[model samples]
Target: MNAPARLRVAAGQATSVPRDVAANVATACSLVTTAADQGARVVVLPELFLTGYAAEEWRHDDSLALDASTGSGGPDERLRPLADLARERGVTVVASAAVRRALDASTLSAVVLTPDGEVRAPYDKQHLCGLEEQGFFTAGDHGATIVVDGWELGLGICYDGSFPEHAASAAAAGATAYLTPAAFFTGSDHRRDLYYAARAIDNGIYVVFAGLTGTCGASSFSGGSAVYDPEGRAVARTGADDPAVVVADLDIAEVRRVQDEVNTVARDRRDSLGHRERLEVGRAG
Candidate 1:
């Protein structure tokens, strides 16, 4: 029997010390160490992880934003340490930070630090939540996808995963795995949990969610970090429980099994429904 493209992924769910990018990056580095120790090739973190998802505090701190130029950090340098850590640990790190698009524009973006320590193109969140105001952030025009070990991993931030159409666009473009880095709040758990799995089954792709867990004073997030299979099954999950690292081995060929049996994306559509008409269907990751 032929084996699938088995990628070991880790969703590192942990709390952050509000407004401290350096400290949060430290926490993420530690978690990445743990996940890497468990043999995870890819580690995806929560949304706005470097800033701890401090929301208004993050929005107000102009100094906290990352620039489009270099992947350095802090007044001295903080983010590069995480990339260095990823290189040392031999893991691909997907972590979010606020990006300064222009002098007047900024957006929440996921930066991939490869195992070789190269900074891939940043995946900016296209669908902004209420907090991402007009002047603060420039909404991204296109979705982002990265090819790793031959797997096309689609990128999405917290609120972006909630919409069916957003994920649909990525799937349309041949994304084998939708990796959502998010900070979902308390009441949003049930809906997000249900929707993440549905996105996997409905699209016949792997869905991996790495979300912020725990509370910061009055604010809190749904701590459920999870990974779902193409069959819409929970390969790994951590509910609103604790800061933990959940890892799963995704069988990429299942995309073919599910599609060959059901064939939703290829057979069920009418006119792409306002979406562009380029079919980039994946060959099982």
Candidate 2:
């Protein structure tokens, strides 16, 4: 039999200020290290943690982009040092930023760094929020899912999590875990909490929300980072406390048990998604 499948994950919650790339990177690196030291192999940060969400500088600057149209975000410009951080700390990091496509347009991206310090292919956020059009970021064509170790992981940004379609799509794609990196402000917690549990239980998968914890412009980021198990129960969470790492251990065996017994995904997987005017394979809503 295969060795028992287990993964230790951490959601790193911190504030990212506008126009402060170095500081944001430093904070992420520190949190990544802390998570690694705490035995977490995977560490996730809030959306746009590199340059801060809603930062005008990111919209205007091409060099601030994570990847260029040439298909590669060359090491230095892409914060290749983050790979070094992962390599040194023996952890994989998931974080988001902007990838410049043109002088006036960029893609909101979720970047994955391997333990070997390699920048893995990034997942661009497919859904944009209200008034985000005021910014220069472009909507990605589709969402993405990837396998990490034995776990199939899916990526979602802030607003993307609100729609059941995104998580359902990942689940249909064989994602056993979903991570949403958000910079949600006050009054958004309840909805997020509701869906986080709903999505996990509906799909019989684990979910993690890595949230921010401070103010930006007129908004106040509420730092309620949390993780939920396949049963849709909160396994770990930050008490809206200061910047912190909310860590948890997930088991693939448990996921299998849930599927074999409870098996919700199997019952509704086909009903929600389809091809050609057909509902998406995983989209229930």
Candidate 3:
């Protein structure tokens, strides 16, 4: 079924408690509640939010990784609250964490909990950065897109958004919006915004960023979570240095207008260099 032209989404920016899944999950639940109260049907949170973004510190801590073992499909007990919240609020929640069956097999993953209380296939971060590459996370092999309210949302992590092809693949896979969970450091807002805006304009898709805020380990996050339209305009954004949520309505009509009249990047894309593979699509139950 096709969703309406407009869908309201929320980006929740907050700090994670170092290695404390309980506290972080509690905060995430609160954010979901707040976003739902504001009528947002989809809510996004920061990268590795289950445990604060301290790759060097928790890199080898097996206890910090959420269980992603593929067997009898059961949601991680620690994250059951989020699934329950999603079901109760009728919202799709995108949140990230380090997940693995073992320490060496860990991946930084974005968990998509839908309104039906199912933990969909998690989108693993495909691009690993400095500390993340140093034995902390294994890069994902393919991209993931999910259906929420009939909108195809492409999933990306912080570093993944830096590459143009990453977002392009999602757009090629029929995604109208790219949802990113980022843990951008303080003072990198310019680069962050540029990357997001460029990706949006390049693919003619909305770019939604949900960032970490406050201090964590040796890094401080100035939350500049935002939503950029297909034309790279800032539709909505949150303030810095604090926990906040920004809600915006994403209209497919704008994307259609841009692709049809303004930017013709999609039509100009070549199959050789441009993305050709359709991303695995998970539909909300």
* Cα lDDT tens digits for candidate 3, 1-285: 797999999999888887788888899999999999999999999998886787656755643434466511457677788889999999999988776646457778887888889876468888898864546677888799888879999999998999999999999989999999998889988998899999999989999999998988878887889999998988998768467999999999998999888998976987776656878789958
Worst 10 residues of 2 by lDDT: 69-78
Which segments of model 3 are wrong by more than 4 Å? 59-67, 272-285
List the candidates' TM-scores in order.
Answer: 0.86, 0.88, 0.90
By TM-score, how accurate is candidate 1? 0.86
> Using TM-score as the measure, what is the rank order of every candidate, best first?
3, 2, 1
What is the lDDT for 85 in model 3? 94
In angstroms, give how far residue 7 of model 1 lies from its true place. Answer: 0.7
User: What TM-score would candidate 2 get against the native?
Assistant: 0.88
Give all candidates' CA lDDT scores. Answer: 0.78, 0.78, 0.85
Cα displacement (Å) at residue 17, model 2: 1.6
- Of models 1 and 2, which has the larger lDDT? 1
TM-score of 3: 0.90
Q: On lDDT, who's better, 2 or 3?
A: 3
For model 3, which pairs clash?
none
Ranked by TM-score, the better of candidates 2 and 3 is 3
